[model samples]
Target: MSKPITKTNNWVLGLTGGIGCGKTAVSNMLEELDVTVVDADIIARQVVAPNSDGLNAIIEYFGQNILLPDGTLNRAELRSKIFTNNENKEWLNALLHPLIRLKILTDLNNATSAYVVLVAPLLFENNLDKYCNRTLLIDVPIATQIERTAKRDNTSIEQVKSIIAAQMPRNEKQQKADDILNNDRNLSLVHTELVVLHKNYLQYALQNTTNAP
Candidate 1:
């Protein structure tokens, strides 16, 4: 069973955004500010590493074509397959989410920092936000999201939009955030916002106890 969410001396922050919303950039800024940031994407990759059960399960589902001759999953080929095909997409999520959740919770329970930031692209969609004391959303305009991702990933606009469509919308994310950082403009502004968030979260962490609501 999952552990219950309670206010603790350790502050748990959920950082999330839609595709191409610059969540990684915002997370890097938080890390610079001394926050203990745990990225779900990073852990996802780790859980599925060669010889791991997660990778084994994925291979069983999709077969050897999804793997390298060296035995590692061919991530690029897998991405191409799932992102282009709707059925394969759901199949992938069904294979991955439970194991990812278990890994995240185990890591989070062991965290000793003043606060731990869980950076998840689908924080709300996956219902992981319930564990966070506060949720932060990194936001950008749809046009900005498409353009930035296309330039960075070297993919077409339609491809970027396809990824975006698979995620929860920006407005829904905004409504759920306790804090929102808009990164479409000046980078400095985002840093300033993080400063405020760091201070506020520190204070919140101090006051939080097992009984805190």
Candidate 2:
């Protein structure tokens, strides 16, 4: 294991959950409260943009067939290739994880909010939680995850299940989390809970600032 990447002057709250578990909703609520959110998904796309080094390297290894007619990545084709082959998945992870992590760190460090939310689906899997002052998991039942993801993405249930299997298990994530927010209820209820969490995070951020030498 590597040491946690230290932030320059921000309190980071690592937020994650399995697909369709309302991680976005929670992040959005926090953002409405003026919290800075450093989203790994957005950074992932930025790192592999049309003319990026990440894209060029991917094309070099997987060939131009991995790209679309518009010179952007053919994500569906690449996803199919990686999902069926563990070696390809590992290779892709090796190439992209570091780049994503660096970009996430940069964004988090640059954020000017009282606290920052680092939102990554693979937060614990990639050891990103280690960078946080605390970790939060947006939890839901597996059935809910499969149903919601299938409906939202228009993907088959089996495909959603496969993606869920690839993630850290729900119980394992619960064990790792410093806080867990059950997202099985309505959005209004979730937001109500989040307001309290947001206040707690603000206080933690203040304490971190006060204690910094």
Candidate 3:
């Protein structure tokens, strides 16, 4: 159900978490609550779609071998390149971050909800958190992150550790959050927490709007 109408125009909420922290699930839950959701990863993929300028830049930086026979980016190949090479990883981020940010801004500008949820795995790393009025972090333990990632991605522990290392520390992320969603337990508990948070957010929105010019 939609929140009661108030003077608050809109809010941009950045949703983030460490690897395997269920950020996607939280985004989905927000969408089910009728909150607009803008996903950075989806926008990143769009900007890199075949024949796009992003694809061209990537090819120039890494060569055509990263593309499949049909000329689409072979994500597995690109993942391997960036994951295995630190410089390549930096180059990819440099090329994609600006483009992704632009698209995210465009999407946020058109959002019609009381607030919008922007899901970014590296919200802090990329400094995109600055664009948000509030930040929501999905908190999960480091050990759980490693175990979940290893099992979910079907990758070795070392590989999972590498990905985790590439992200901000869990404690640092938690400290940066305006609101924290603990996702270490089952869905039932998570849903109850979300319900309470949603009500609080609605009240907050109402107050903010009432005080706005």
Candidate 4:
């Protein structure tokens, strides 16, 4: 693993939320504002890309059935297996978390942003908040989560509900947050909040660091 960003300088903001809470939308807005955003989901996929060490390790343990005909991960099949079985989930995490963490650290260390956002759906669950100077939670009602997720994923409401149930709950995440972005309404409303947040984060990062990340 690459060495962590120097301890004397801290500019990382860990951004997270439950399913369908619009974390991606917020991240996109931040990116458009020229803030660097390192998405863990993207890194997670990279670590397990075909022929990578992560993928080879996974196949060694879980068999070739997890791969699609094109030699890529059949994510839906793997998701069903892991979530249905606790041991499977634990095993997958054990193999992949270190790989993903190394990549994230390296990216953060190299980033030139005034501050960087480390976006992870499992930011809290995976204890990634430790890497951040602060945590930002995108908040929404459970009903909103279920409704939006069902629509976006083309899955049943029950399936969305089950996924939500498996993740850290909304209330718990909200309580742990250092900042919140309420995403209950339209994008314009969320964008308004984000404008304030972008300024706040920029100022906060400037206050915290002597120089850029």
Best by TM-score: 2
TM-score of every prediction relative to native: 0.86, 0.92, 0.86, 0.88
* Per-prediction backbone clash count: 0, 0, 0, 0
Model 2 residue 163 CA deviation in Å:
1.8
| lDDT for each residue of candidate 4 in 93-123, tens digit (9 for 90 to 100) | 8999888998898888778988999999999
Among all windows of 10 consecutive residues in model 2, the one with the lowest summed lDDT is: 2-11
lDDT of 3 by residue, 45-95 (tens): 899998899999999988999899999999999999987799999988888
Better-scoring candidate (TM-score), 3 or 4: 4
Local accuracy by lDDT, each model: 0.85, 0.93, 0.86, 0.89
Candidate 3 or 1, higher lDDT: 3
Model 1 TM = 0.86
In model 2, which regions exceed 4 Å deviation? 1-8, 84-87
Off by over 4 Å in 3: 1-9, 60-63, 79-91, 208-213
Clashes counted in candidate 1 amount to 0
Sort the predicted structures by lDDT, highest score first.
2, 4, 3, 1
> Model 4 segments beyond 4 Å from truth?
1-10, 80-88, 211-213
How would you encode candidate 1's per-residue C-alpha lDDT over 26-116 as one tens digit per residue?
A: 8898888777788899999988899999899888888888899998889999999887799999988887887788778767777877788
Candidate 2 lDDT, 19-129, residue by residue in tens: 999999889989899999999999999999999999999999999999999999999999998978999999999999888888888899899999999999999998888
